[model samples]
Target: MNSDLLILDYEPAHQPAFRALNHEWIAHYFTIEPIDNEMLDDPEGYILAPGGHIFMASHGGAIVGTCALIKEHKGVYELAKMAVSPRAQGLGIGWALGQAVVAKARQLGAHRVELLSNARLRPALALYAKLGFRHVPVPPTPYQRTNVKMVLDL
Candidate 1:
């Protein structure tokens, strides 16, 4: 736990790590089945596209966490795809990544930042609350898989 955790922009070579993080998070946290190839392929375009940024945290040269910011509307961004490796949890990595994304949102002059999460993700819910994200009764998502939506005013 004394190792330095480096946070930097996502790299093309780190796509597999990012994919693995996403897959594990969704499957384990959401209790959903693993993603298929098509779903896995979807992140490539976003990770490599403009108007979005990916930040990753590495410990001991291993990618332990990742977070992404994608433009949602005129003045809002979606804080999507945040995950920390199970072995690396409870180390404040998620809080650091959350602050990084909020800083990025402010840099972009975003009015608000939003994220969706499942009700069962209590740790994430607490983290979001600690970071000033207020829950909304209804979310903007069409999918019913998520029950909690929180927005941070920037």
Candidate 2:
């Protein structure tokens, strides 16, 4: 990771950057679904208000990556909306953000953390695996693009 890269908590000022980063990645691989719009449009309502958290990675004073842990009932969090700017892809921003979110979930007393992803996103899946997430049976999901599910026990 870059020595200057910092993972910070989300604030209202980060709304546009958060949405743009996520939209850029999702649209590149799959169609943006209604659920994506709902979450991206009002992260505070759908995520933070429910006791979840969002983390942003800043490098050279620019937002370069983001990740979120959405509370899903007691002691469970869904790792979602992770993205790294194309320019920052090789700087380990994604790993830093992922570690931050997982650490946050554990700090919040989460028993498990799960994520929904696509098989085609091999790099992401590898990252998740490296973070201690293991493949699990895919549950029905709102996003048409999701075909892989993984979980990490805390």
Candidate 3:
């Protein structure tokens, strides 16, 4: 593989890969399913709702990572659903996808970004912090697994 990952918008054909990415990490860190097939198939419904955008990282011909940006408030965006294949971690694909999301947010005229994560995901939290995301108190949500909230000012 070239290893030069290209980040692009969600496409119907890439849903399987995206779902696999989500499932893999969810299985590792949380007991619940992160995303179901139906949700992946209906990208526009859940993933793309709230003015959100999905992105995937492709290297050679395979999708290796995925991320999403959801509109939170006026000029505020929520960065969500970031996952990299286990085989693809340590290759900077996660960072690539994150920068892509930030660039996407900039392109969309967003002023800030935020994300929800679990304390169990230390690597991901470290990566977000390295990328300038500061931790905030966790929000009260139905999802019990989430323990940290990260925010970034663009």
Candidate 4:
């Protein structure tokens, strides 16, 4: 990890940064889905209130990346909404965030962590792979952009 980077749990004040960072990357590659709008509109209600968690990455006091762990069932979580600011792409911010989120999942007692992603996001896929995620059959998904599914057993 970088000396200046911090990965922290989601806070109320981070709402806007959470929404903006994710929306920027999603829109850059594909249009947002209704499910995305639902959570982005009410993260605390949709995620935190439901026993899930979000993680934010900051560098030198500025929020630069975000990721979420959405509880889908007992002992299982969906890793979602990971995004890094365009300017910070090559700095390993995403990798740091991913590693932090997975560690959080283990601490939370989650037995498995899975994710739905688009196959076209090669860099993100590679990052997940390096973090111990492996390919699985693509399940039915709300987002038209999603074509790849991966999971990591905690």
Q: Which one wins on lDDT?
A: 2
TM-score order, best first, reads: 2, 4, 3, 1
Per-residue alpha-carbon lDDT of model 4 for 7-64, expressed as tens digits?
A: 9989999999999998999889899889888899899999899998999999988999
Residues 21-93, model 1: lDDT tens digits: 8779887755443343333456657544647778899877888999988788788998878999999998888
Query: By TM-score, is 1 or 4 better?
Result: 4
Residue 77 of model 4 has an lDDT of: 97
lDDT of 3 by residue, 73-115 (tens): 8889988879898888888888888888898899989999999
Q: For each candidate, what is the lDDT? A: 0.80, 0.95, 0.82, 0.92
List the lowest-lDDT window of 10 residues for candidate 1.
Answer: 31-40
**Candidate 4: regions farther than 4 A off:** none
Q: lDDT: which is higher, 2 or 4?
A: 2
lDDT of 1: 0.80
* Candidate 3, superposed: residue stretches over 4 Å from native: 1-3, 33-41
Q: How do these models rank on lDDT, best leading? A: 2, 4, 3, 1
Q: Between prediction 2 and prediction 3, which has the larger TM-score?
A: 2
lDDT of 2 by residue, 1-154 (tens): 6888999999999999999999999999999999999999999999999999999999999998899999999999999999999998988888898899999999999999999999999989999999999999999988899999999999
Give me the overall lDDT of model 4: 0.92
